[model samples]
Target: MSQATETLVFIPEDISSARSGAFRADWQMRSLAGETMGTHWSAKFSSPEQLDLQAIELSITQNLDTVISQMSPWETDSDLRRYQKAASGSWCAFRPEAFHVLERALSIAQETDGAYDPTFATAVDLLGFGPSPHSGYSYASPEVQQAFAQAGYQKAALSAETNSLFQPGNLRVDLCSIAKGFAVDLVCQRLRELGLENYLFEIGGEAKGLGCKPDGLPWLYEIEPPPNAKASLSKAQVALCGLAVATSGNYLRYEQRHGQTVAHIVSPRCQDGDDKLLSVSIFHDSCMEADAYATALFLLGAEAGLAFADKRNLAALFQTADDLLLSGRARKLLG
Candidate 1:
């Protein structure tokens, strides 16, 4: 029988180098976890002082709650839903957090040429993957076609000065692809504000790490293998020092319809999910970017996605049924 393999990738750093001060003998590893956005979030950090764990948890939960209030499509009163309900041509003001996420989402949509549109909420709902009851609409159905017609990120406009978004006649916005990662970033920021530096923060599967462990070792994160992967497949892990990683795949959230496998990730380009690649993982300095890029690359497929990553010099790993493909930058990270 073939044995499984493991690959550790990291940027070389001195063992004695510590961004959060030299690891103290008294420093202890602390952990916290909570539920949010129909998922779980966790944190592991090194701290020397006797910190109030309860207070830290409260702050983290509050930060996550703020993201849901502003961006969650399931929340009827959320800023995103409110904007969706607004009449066309009217500009709706939003909180700084919501505005920031929307701005970034649009920027990415433009960058990927609508491959990662934020205005595909209607299509997502029609395909039985979103908050609304699925309409049982096929890709050729009128409902699905109309949804696709209206699903263009260019239709929307943002006013940075006012922190507002213009709704272009029933344009529905969904930030599901990027919101959770933003929440992770928010938690990391909160940790820093609380004077804790050496930490690994994660929401759902997206994660970001700061500083180093108490023993001066970087926090290591193992990429999740695809479902039913062979035992001989090599496991790849990266040291999460000052980096965030996100993975998108069809195996996690997909359904069978009429003998067709429909994934949850609805591409704006085609109004259907693309399962050509088993999964795509993106590594960046920001969790939000990593999360959005992972979804985009998954929709773009293996060939085009590889080209996109290479053009941007992005660190990306694309996994197919028979092969593991890494971008030029990704290959450099292997130790």
Candidate 2:
């Protein structure tokens, strides 16, 4: 077993510094939560007088459901499932939101050189992390090899004008790496539409914040440390003002095979998983980007990931059993 040996401290900055105006003092803090995407979704916002909490909650749930209906691999009728079953060279149309997410996922895949891929549904399922139950397929098994051969972001084509995706036979798309963060963004959009400017929105652990709290303080979010971290390691917290933060770690989801731990986050380039780096956390203006980058960085492993983050100027923190690595941008932010 390994332990986290260092800490990064982040001070909460004034939200008004990032926004145009100060928050109103008369507003009250309100919270609403519900289940979505097989996990919980929550909101903490500065509510205006006479605001209808129930109606807002309903709208948030509906928006989350919309993402599931379009992107969920578990949903048989989802747009992704439809595209998966489409014949080779056929264009499958998608709703605007889903199309946008798919487009972004592919972009990240290309940027990372396929370290992160959305077309790994079959591989994911065989690795015991997808919609279907695992069937004892080893990494070197023929079934797994065939699934890997079929998974590649470049194999699919996107049409920006038509909002459609081209299916190349047996190519399955899974947005699990990025969809939850998109849901958080969608919820935040709804909140803004209702004139709520100060709030924190989250789905599954990916989160975003807008403006300030009712007390004029930024929303403080605690970064989750790796499971093997030392108890004495000081905790890290970030001021989520006009920003989103996402963390991905091997401990979040895994399985034991042949007395070794196998993480759910598989590297498409390697066609396998590596748990050497405990986790990676990324901060960005968009929760979706933060989420995808976290996965991509983790797959790239510690040294390469840190270099990539620095080159890209991404605020990223990578933690392993005995070491902690931070990009130049992450150091500036934490310092």
Candidate 3:
């Protein structure tokens, strides 16, 4: 796998603490890592004593399983799958977790003018990047068009009072864009419940951090260069403190279909031409939101994506073929 060149490292204060043995004597740094959502996840925290590492790892895995059960497009028995097969115009209630994710998705779709739609499952599957009944279909085929026509995030009516969702027609929902980040956020919460105030949690490259190291310094992450780029390239690092970051890029995930290479990300607007934008990274208070926005910004390409980010005052970094651009908000925050 191509690695993100930027690695998180302990700051000078942390090095000093390690040398003095002031923090290590009183606190133990424990770590757990495992697989989730077709990728790996990890958690690192400082605690005064040894923890039930086995139980904590199991809980983290179970949490990821719960998310997959609710959102995986590959699973036929998933709640989303059942909803997709349900009769049109029928109401399907969601579990609390699924409900919350869908609610946020719909809101983001509206906010981005459908830039980050959960209803792009058809296009995604058609591209052979997702599982489905729609795979192997050409992008311009009637079936793909019909599926796109039938799906729209706006059409799905939500009722918070009843915790029920009503599909206007044959809309199929896929939560791939934001589900992993939500899982990361959930793990962070679990860590807090274990009385861990200083920790970092990551799932599928989307990460969030809280508090600080025992030495009172923040966790740092080096944003990597685009995939396939020479690793000798350097990028900036950001300190994580009650913040989450997510990156979306086609360089990492794409497949050749019909003699043409198509990326995994599908734009609801129209076919993207000569996709020049390489990658996008977003920072936000919520990992889920960061994930969703990263995808949206990537779909919008460089110019429009930068404009949108600036308009929303979002902290976003867009990497193009030749250079890296930071939104005004990102510069203000990271500069």
Candidate 4:
């Protein structure tokens, strides 16, 4: 059997090497993990002398539930689903949290010329990649075509002052590309409010870190190499310090449609599966930005994607069918 790629793996560090001065003498390395958004999440941090694991876990779960309630398209009562069901040409009162995500998603979509779009909800459902999977969905069907037609970021307008959103068409927004990363950042924020630093936060494959270990060493992460025949997850690791990382890969999350295999990622330009690149990883100060850009660059393919990252001096790594490429800044970070 071909092993599935690990995608992202935590690299354990020797506690002795971490800086100790910032923490108490009794400080200990601790790890916490849970499942959320249909995937697992984890956190590692150096704790001071006293910490309440139970309270922290409860807070984490509550925050993640709030995130899902606001943005998950899978939930019928979610704010996103409510917006999708809203009548066209009507402005709906939007939750500030959901609007924030949409605003950032729209910004990235515009920057990438619609490569990373939040308006793929219908396409996602038709492709059997959404909460409810269906067989026999076709890209050529009128329903699917209509879904494509509703997919322009320009069609959605946000009012920051009123916290309202206008859907100009039958547009339905999906935040799968960026919500998890935003959730990770929120969890990190929660930790900060509790007076904790030196933590690594990850949900699904999106991750962010702040401060350093007790010994003051940055968290390390292993980005699986280009998938192989066996599809094992083994590769060189990178160190991340006060940064965030997110990756998009076509090896997994695929479905069979019309007797052909297709990736789950939907491109706004093609309104179909994007298959040009094998994988792309993005590093940024904000996990949300990294998550959205990773999907965007993957859809842009190797040449244009690399150029995009290079022009912005973004830290990114791209893996193609035949070669591995890194943005100049990413190369330096990896080096």
Best by lDDT: 1
Clash totals for all candidate models = 0, 0, 0, 5
TM-score of each: 0.93, 0.92, 0.87, 0.87
Choose the strongest candidate by TM-score.
1
* Candidate lDDT (C-alpha), each: 0.83, 0.81, 0.76, 0.76
Q: How do the residues 189-282 of candidate 4 rate in per-residue lDDT, one tens digit apiece? A: 8988988767888887788877677765667766665554233523545555567889987787765666555567775444445455678989
Candidate 1 yields a Cα-based lDDT of: 0.83
The list of candidate 2 runs beyond 4 A from truth reads: 1-7, 11-15, 19-21, 24-26, 268-274
- Residue 286 miss distance in model 2 (angstroms): 0.2
Candidate 2 C-alpha lDDT tens digits along 1-335: 13543556653233456554356778888899889888888899775566788999899989999999999999999999899789888999999999999999999999988888988788888878888877655566678778888788888888899999898788898899999889888888888888877889888789998887777777888888788865655566777888889999878777667554556776544434555688898988889999999999988888899999999999897877665677888777773
Winner of 1 and 4 under TM-score: 1
* lDDT per residue (tens digit) for residues 173-259 in model 3: 888998988988888888778666778888877998876666666667767678655454346666666778899988787666665
Q: Candidate 2: worst 10 consecutive residues by lDDT?
A: 12-21
User: 16-124 in candidate 1: lDDT tens per residue?
Assistant: 3435455665689999998999889999988877789999999999999999999998899999889978988899999999889899999999998988898988888
Candidate 1: misplaced stretches above 4 Å?
Answer: 1-4, 12-20, 268-274
lDDT of 2: 0.81
